[model samples]
Target: MSISRLSSALVASLLLFGAACGDDTVGTSPNNMTTPPGVDVPIPMGSKLQHTGQCAGQVNCQVDVTFNSSAPLQVRVIDGNGAPVVGAAVRYELSVGLAVGTSLNAASAQTNSDGVAQVEIRAGQATGAAEVIVSLPGDTSVAPIKFVAGVQPKDSASYSVTFEHAGTASLRDIKVFLYKAEDSCDAIREDIARERDDDASTNPVLTAEYTANGVASVDGTLPLVVFPGLSNGQSFNVAAQAMSRDDGEVELAFGCTDSNPPIENGNSVNVIVRLEDHLPRLKGSFDVTHTFSITDAICDPQPNGGYAGVLPSGVCLAIDLIGRLATDPASFILGEGSGDTGIIGLIVDFLPDDGILGTLKGAIESFLGNSLIQNLGRDALNEFFATWIENNAPDWVKGGIDITADIYESLQEFRVNGIIRIEREPDPTLDTETNTVVGLLNADQDGNRPGKQVWEDIIVYWTGDCASSAPAACRERTFSATDLGATSSVVEGSFTGTVVPLTGEGETGFGLIINEHTLALNYGVLILGIIEQVVLPSIFGPTVTSLEAALNELLLLVLPGGTTGCQGFADFMVDNIGSSVETIARNLCESLLESASDGIREFLTENLTISGEDNFLLATPTGTPCKLVEPEAYTGAWIGKPLPYIDGLGTDSMLCEWDVKIRISQDTIIETDGTFSGNRTGF
Candidate 1:
């Protein structure tokens, strides 16, 4: 009678087959069964539930689904006899929650041969919980099962990072910058460019500083990078950099937002980056040091050349006179190859060769013959000597003689003191600048014209007796000279020149030339006395002095082949001795110039370096940085002493001493004390 029960005819059929009915089927068991009442029979289907995909975790009674996401809901249909109902129909229904917008594809579907029917449950864009039910169409014996699903905001996340090096974790006082995916253009471009051997340029989106060692934090003080509005499956790139305090070098890190715990759909993610340094760093300063020596090749007082006493040849008398007269004070010794040695070494070493003295002698002779001594012509000189011979009454003197004899000597003490300063121009070009450094020799800063007066405060002291006690040639002590005072004197003029950089291919070079300059000697007391008293009377004595007249007449008794009168002897001695001192002073100036320009070049070329972390020079790929610092200014001072400059190799060689100080600044030199001194032995 009840529609839910199986019919008697069906029961008769079941009895004939000895089948049984059970409650495991879609509805209650059939009304009739051939088996015993307690017997349980097979059932092809049950009221149990199951699901696939996003809805798999849903309760069997109430399957849930996500918004805008699709999933399958299935149920099996069978007969009370536990056999599948080939064409049975199943009903489906959806119950959407209050904030959800979604629905099922169909409310009903026919069961397949396996007694199963599936309906796809699709969700809407809105987020909220939803439910689905599955059951037999008209049979109320079995309860419908329900499944639930939910749609929430998409997954999104964020990250924080720190840097480290050589196991040291602290990254103090370094700058950090973060760039978004779009803003990471600089990082990507640089990466590609570096691959092609090109230079890289940087660009950043946001920046922050790290004060803690090794740690860059993203907290309340520093906000973490957030991707707040990303939907499912979307992502972006990220780049960051940490830089040195001095801006000398940098380190970089890169990442992607698409990584797990992904930035998409309200999800959050965290990242950490460790950096390694590869770029070169910038430098601040560098330095170089040099030591120089002094030698007798240029400083020797003996014009005769080579060591004294070793050779049989005697010393030159003219050299001895000039050397002793040009004394360098003991307080300021200029050239000290060895500590406290003397200016004789300094002045002489800086001067030219003895051969140059010969040239100066010719020059002086020309000047005297044409100007100062013009009053005494050759014929007059002959007549004067002839008169002396007539009055003296010597048979050998009846014929006039040639008064030309070689007078060789060595100086007891030759002294010179001066200031050598180096300076650089304000605007120096690269390698091509001319006269960038202006050299002032003994420059005067206090006079009417500052930096214009040169060769100032020069001292040439001569205080020694000349002429041997024995009579080798003329009468003994007849033409003797003594006690040239030790008073100091200065040259009247100055020397100005320019220093040029002789830069060659990959090496440092130097050059210098005196542009507009002059060093004029203002012969003071000693020189004037020698010219007027000693020289004037020594060779032309018979004609000009009674003391020499008697001696000249007595010379014939000693031997033959000698000058009865002072014919040409005065000119010869004056020419050789007088001209020699001039050349010596000039040569000394040249030596000072060479020391400055050449010394600077050699020091830089051999010693400059750029990168290693110390006082010694460190080299870089570019070049040695020390070479880049140009000379700015210079200041110098010197004091002479009585200590003689003696050679370590020979006991006979000796000269005056000087203590000199030359302070040079690369930018500008200010003379706190404009002290200068000059000494000259002139005709």
Candidate 2:
């Protein structure tokens, strides 16, 4: 037998057994009561009444109780005479609107001595208004009581969008997506509607049915959005994109907004979206160059009689010996040319541990030591020593041994300081003409747009020490030779130029010509030493004093000082000799700057390779109504402009004026293979 039938049989058997037991209530049994057989006790009219408290709720639609809180629904009954109706059967029922989709918890309660009854009514997951009913069993005079409440869904955002393609062309079956501002629309959509393989197609917070029809002729059409209920003030990103029969994939438009402003408690917002011609971005490389000329003067010091008392006084130097030894300032161009050793490759990426000085510190010493000696050949040096003895030695003391010479160059310390700034701006005049849009530059006409820009916040930093050999004591000095270590080098600078506003034009639209940007080495000094060895007789023998002033001048020009060899001198060239040590140092720094430019260029190229295939929709201010619509193929070429910022939704911003181009090749078909004459179109 079925469980139900067996339970009924058991209940009936128990009832029969109870009836067989006589006077179970003892002296108070109804059978022992001696009363008139036909008479019946009637409840007073005023005592029959109703009383109740708000019914609490759980998993059902809202009523007097809070949903999921498990609060109890209550009811009370009384007789017509105002006395409590004890032992009365009370029933509680729940009902929901059919369209709203919710259910009620069924429960029954018995009135106690106080005529009170209650049941816990649960709320359903679905949201909508619902009613709870309470009534007594077979009551002729009492009416039922209905307690009503409204259920609310979880938090979400709703949006209504209207789409148009290339002016008045209406688009059908376009897919719309809403997602968290920080998430990807495609990823979110996949999670919401997984494919048959159970793999997510895309992840989206919410999605709507494909648009069946769109009336492009009208300005504002009925909404094509159906979103779940959202809490007030919630934010979301909205994207509407689709692929065309001709175009591969196109981004119509996207925006971000708070649910409160555009979405009312019971109303929807109307968003207008327009599709535009997309341009393919090109991938290629280019070069940068900077040239400069530097010149300075060198001063010579007067000789001291005490240091060279026996020197011949006949030779008079016209200009300072140091100036005479100096070479004319030369012109130098620095940039990235071909490879590491190339002229432009002087600048290189250095880690915190490696610096320019770390590699070139030896170069400084070589330039100071061997440069002048190599220029003055051995013959010239031999004649100079012979002349020194012939011209200055007293006539009575004539005699000179071959003056053995050993030249050594030493560098105790040096420092170099450098700064570089680069920037790019859009052309404000070109806008929406010739299929181009401009005026996205930093401007404030009505003040709604922010004047800040991308480059304004850019901070270029150099973090390594340029001079690792610098003395520890000198390293702390700011802008000094020892201070050549890396520091914050970005300068507050601006660029004024024009980019062709990316208008599907494959030609380079952005061009910036940075002329000789001055990279000044403001402070710091190089300590160079030229140590020479020679022997002189102790008493009346030929002394350094016996040398002619010309030889003395030569020595003074090359060495730091005649008396104190420890003195330091600056390698400033006032004229051009055959070779110049100053020129070499200057060239090294220039090459360093050029290498830096190469690095900066590479940084920009790697960071800014934006393409139409990315399908990113940048925000842009709606310009004046589009007056012309042209359908053309976009050829991917070097536009030479930085990729515009995309997904500017909730940010309340848009892309600067620019053009994007995309090209789709049409297929050719012939009735006969290659020789066919009949016209056919396809690929």
Q: How many residue pairs clash in each candidate?
A: 83, 66
Tell me the TM-score of model 2: 0.21
Q: 356-387 in candidate 1: lDDT tens per residue?
A: 74454344334333422233222333343344
Decoy 1 TM-score against native: 0.21
TM-score of each: 0.21, 0.21
Query: Evaluated with lDDT, which candidate comes out highest?
Result: 1
User: Cα RMSD (Å) between model 1 and the true structure?
Assistant: 30.7
Q: lDDT per model, in order?
A: 0.31, 0.30
lDDT of 2 by residue, 76-105 (tens): 566765666655666676656421444444
> Candidate 2, 154: how far from true, in Å?
37
